[model samples]
Target: MLDVRASLGECPVWCSNDQSLYWVDISAPSLNRFDPATAINTAWKMPESIGSFTLRKAGGFVAALRSGFWLIDRDGRLERKLIDAPYDSTHHRFNDGRADAQGRFWAGSMNEKRDANTARLYRLDPNLKLSAMIDDIMISNGLAFSPDGRILYHADTPSRTVHAYDFDETAGTLSNRRIFIRFEAENDRPDGAAVDREGCYWSALYRGGKVVRISPGGTLVGEYELPAQCPTMCAFGGPDLRTLFVTSARQMRDPEELARLPQSGGIFAMRVETPGLPEPRFAG
Candidate 1:
């Protein structure tokens, strides 16, 4: 575990080139890099809350911050604004996201109020054009692509539903949306997720204190219990990509609960039998 104790840790992206993990603490409004070899972590403060980010092929990162899409350098400096916030920043902010295999960055927004469905998903092309894709979402969270890059999986946390879409990699479009998985537990909401080499979807269950692996057909295959109650996201890392890294949250927890789970916001890891695909970098 990399025990930085973040307020709300999310988006754990592995950098195979450096063998380090890049992640964000949304509530802390910072970007962080963790070196497992030395147990050292470095952080870059952001001007505002940053939801998610993907490494750019050209260098640095393309981030989804409170204001909108922005290009951030390796040192966390905001280099350029890619687009303005399409939704009202006061009520919504970009949340979970990543770059597809074709190099297009896709991100989804969340309604902070949790009382309305005003959030939407967006796609940023390599040419720098931004387009809205899905709408009427409440808490956009899980975002991952199949190993073959032919299917996209997404989840609406508040609704406890994960959806699959037929992806047209060449055109960067989604169609034939259908339910991939649905949680029946009232408190178990699907959060951030990742797909393994075998096409199994691994999802972090927020408030459920566990991570679940579901086959491509939507059957639950395995479960990994976590000490933290609010695990926000998971990523595949390590030299062999067999290490599953999970990020959690400490914000808005009861004092008693925080006392029980001292590493509530720390990053956790476990070895897995299957490896994960390398994260795709933004072509832009």
Candidate 2:
């Protein structure tokens, strides 16, 4: 475990080149790099809350911050502003995102006020073009793509449902949206997710205290109980991509609860049988 104690840790991405994990503390508003070998974490404070980010093909990162999309260099310097926040920055911000196999970046926004379904999903092409792909979303989360790149999985956290879409990697589009999985338990709110090479979708249940593995056919096949009640996201990393790293949150927790779960905001990891696909880099 990496004991960084983040406030709202999310978006764990594996950096195969350096054999390290990159993640963010949304509430802390910082970018972090964790090295498993040394158990050392490096951080970069951000001007605004950073929702998610992915490595760039050339170098550095393509991030979705509260203000908008940006190009940040390896040294944490903002290189350029890709676009302004498409929605009102006061009520909405980018939440979950990743790059597709084709090098296109996709991100979803969330309605912080929760008063309406005003959030939307967007796509950022390699040429710096931005487009809104899906709309009427509340809390956008659980963004992952199948290994074959033909399916995209997403979840609206407050709705407790995960959805799948027929993805067109070439044209960078989605179609035939359908319910992939729906949680009946009140605590099983789907958050961030990852797809293993076997096509199994692993989702971190926000308040459920566990990560569930769902079969490609939308069946709950396995589960991994976590020490923290609020695991925000998970990523597969390590030498062979067999280590499943999970990040959790400590924001707003009662003092007693925090004492009971001291590792509430720390990063945890475990071995897994099926390896995960290498994270795709933003081509732009």
Candidate 3:
């Protein structure tokens, strides 16, 4: 497995233009970028907790912070642009996010208190406005849009299932919620997910020690086992979008377990047969 040491690696995203993989470490308060060409790693420290991010149409990225969403310049200047989430408990914050075909940003939250229901999902526009999409989320993890942008896929950790919604691209609305796929409860819960060009879902299991490739009809076609327990997220990167980059986490592990798995919090890579859909850009 390709190794990328991370403390709590999450939110893996592929930047085709740069041919690199990017992700965040929320607990670590850092951002990561890996250059496949040189096998090099780069990290940036954040002033506060950062849940996830998406590419901006103009340049740079839009990131979700504990307080709200913000615009991050190429040089790492962070400007808080959205403040509508004041109701979010301080213990809970933004988590995984993905862009819709129309360039709107969709992100979810997780409860820091574990069993509490203070979490929710949100949709943010370039103008820095926040809209609540779903409520009572336990842990908003990975999210992705369908190849045709007609379906939106989302997963809440420890739930063991990924949910699908009928996406209204023009009106930015979601309906017809249904369970798309379910992972084994004995295994890790579904943490993050991505959709391939063929519309297959690539879901990373948190403690399951594997990533499962499921058909749109909910059939398991394949699996990729990982050396770590908490594989958080996955994204397809590379010149041809055939490389799968995965992020892992060290949280929730005991000291002994952490010692046993040195690569537990690092990133992993593998080659895949199918290419991934082009990541939708943020409307901003």
RMSD per prediction, one decimal? 0.7, 0.7, 1.6
lDDT string for model 3 (33-115, tens) is 77878878787889888889988888888888787778887656786565644455567888889888888898898888788
Worst window of 10 by summed lDDT in candidate 1: 127-136
Displacement of the residue 189 alpha carbon in candidate 3, Å: 0.2
Per-residue alpha-carbon lDDT of model 2 for 108-169, expressed as tens digits? Answer: 99999999999998999999899998898998999999999999999999999999999998
- Model 1 Cα lDDT, one tens digit per residue, 1-284: 88788999999999998999999999889999999999999999999999999999999999999998999998889999988988999889989999998899999999999999999889999998989888889998899999988999999998999999999989988899999999999979999999999999999999999999999999999999998999999999999999999999999999999999989999999999999989999999
Q: What is residue 110's positional error in candidate 1, in angstroms?
A: 0.5
Single out the weakest 10-residue window by summed lDDT for candidate 2: 252-261
Candidate 1 global lDDT: 0.94
Backbone clashes in model 3, listed as residue pairs: 6-266, 188-207, 188-208
- Model 2: how far residue 149 lies from native, Å: 0.7
Cα-lDDT of candidate 3: 0.82
- The deviation in Å at residue 23 for candidate 2 is 0.5
